[model samples]
Target: MADIDMAELGPDRTLLLVDDDAPFVARLARAMEKRGFLPETAESVAAGKAVASSRPPAYAVVDLRLEDGNGLEVVEALRASRPACRIVVLTGYGAIATAVAAVKFGATDYLSKPADANDITNALLSRGEAPPPPENPMSADRVRWEHIQRVYELCDRNVSETARRLSMHRRTLQRILAKRSPK
Candidate 1:
């Protein structure tokens, strides 16, 4: 993705990035900083809420699930402190239900995980306009595989539980899990 025009980001460049994945968050913080944002980062919902309450950043990128609590709480806190704050919610386990809930809770946008810094920047700076289509969208099979993998991890790698939750035969789930992820 190309660099965004910082002039369009308005006068307030403060941005808060909250995610439990420390390395990923750190990397994103660096990337955002290079994009002309004054970035602050938090690794959990509590920290995010605290920052939002005390500082009230003008922009935010938050992971939907955290070790301590839901990211929506941070979004709510940011909105409460700065009503015009641009907040984007991200999750590996993205679903329509959660996306709707995030928006209702005050997020400006919701994106599936593995979103790059460019994607996030566009989301943050968008002025109620839909973004252009992805340059190379994931294939349907890859999407399904990724979703199944996420669910499988969430189920603690229990094949029976994962299969039961997905309503697939145990053997079939096992086969799918064993295969390499599709492109």
Candidate 2:
């Protein structure tokens, strides 16, 4: 990612990056530092909260899932500690439901996994009214898949339980889950 001008970020350039993926976080932290941000890192919800307790960073990038708990916990903590702080929720399992939930939980924006440093930086800086909606949103199949996966997580990945809840045959549900997410 190209290094953004520090002047554009203003004095609020401190960032708290909360993600369990060590390699990805390391790369992002280094990239952000080069872009002139004072970056702090936390690998779990607990650590992120601790960092916020001292003082919320001017911005935060929190992964949607962590070893300890949901990354929304970190977002809420930052919002509570400093409402002015900018927050972006990063998730591999992107879905309309989760994206809406992230924003409802105080995330300024939500980005899918594999987001570049520049992508995150841009999202964190964007403010005010939202852009026009996508002309073509996700397909029904994709939305159903996302909802099934979310329910599977809620059931602690119990295939039978999720199948029961969704009124799906066990093998059918398993097959749906096994397939890669539809575009």
Candidate 3:
């Protein structure tokens, strides 16, 4: 992770990280703490909202999907409690519509998973400037795979429904889902 300057750490360095993935959230919280943040973590929308309401952090990293509900609800709660909070929306299912919605909910940035600690930190600390292009952008094939996987998930992993929605052959969709994601 890139070292963040102390001056840029803001007046309050408390950070809330909300993700259903327990291991990911724990790892990220540890990483952020190493960078001088006082990190709090939640694994569900309800918990996240409760934490936000109780004490809105100075910054937050929220997943778009949670086991209990949409992470956007948590975002909204945080924004309502603390308008100045810098929130970054992170998700595995990245799409333009969701990204726009995240911004509309007062998120400072939207990042697709699996974003590293460095990327999250940069987004959190950015001063409204457009971020530089990704050092290693996803390939077209990877993007397609991600989209298909997202659709498959949305369809409750039904092969036929996912294929029909994507206009792809059922067998082809099955093969893609069976294989590991491309780099």
Candidate 4:
């Protein structure tokens, strides 16, 4: 496959990527390196913060959930360490509240998991791509909400039965669905 125009990023720059998924960290780091960036990978938020604090990077791609803690913490830490560094948050669970909170906390953008190297590279580059839409087909929130809404509606908004069908706690299901807004 052809590479992204690294010029879109306005000169190759250093990038810090924080994700606990080993394969994803390696794959994305390699891809960004090929795209003319010097990318660093961290398997945990603590390590990511350490790298950023020790030597600031031009950009950071942060995962929202980490083995040790929330990736948002890492983003905050990066911002504090290097106020100029750009940040993007990736998560398996993409809620609007979480996404909006990420932006409020200083992420330049947010992406859901299954995002490819190119998507991440573009985010790091600040190339003007919109934050991944909450309703996007790849979005975990859309998929989970739709499924829960279907069951809830089918069960006449009966929280217990809906939760049972989904194999989740009633309260957890309620919280998830509560975050859903009316169309």
Residue-level lDDT of model 4, residues 1-183, one tens digit each, is 336666666553888889998988898888878878888999997898899789878788998988799888888888898887888899876689999999888898888776887777667665565555434353565666666776787788899998898889988987887684433
lDDT ranking, high to low: 3, 1, 2, 4
For model 4 the TM-score comes to 0.70
Residue 40 accuracy (lDDT) in model 1: 96
Q: Compute each candidate's TM-score over C-alphas.
A: 0.94, 0.72, 0.92, 0.70
Question: lDDT tens string, model 1, 50-115?
Answer: 999999999999999999989999999999999999999999988999999999999999999889
Off by over 4 Å in 1: none
Candidate order by TM-score, decreasing, is: 1, 3, 2, 4
Candidate 4, superposed: residue stretches over 4 Å from native: 1-3, 127-183
In model 4, what are the clashing residue pairs, if there are any?
A: none
Looking at model 1, report the run of 10 residues with the lowest lDDT sum: 1-10
Predicted candidate 3 versus true structure: per-residue lDDT over 89-115, tens digit per residue:
999988899999999998999999989
**Residue 80 accuracy (lDDT) in model 2:** 90
- Top candidate on lDDT is 3
lDDT of each: 0.94, 0.89, 0.95, 0.80
lDDT of 2 at 155: 91
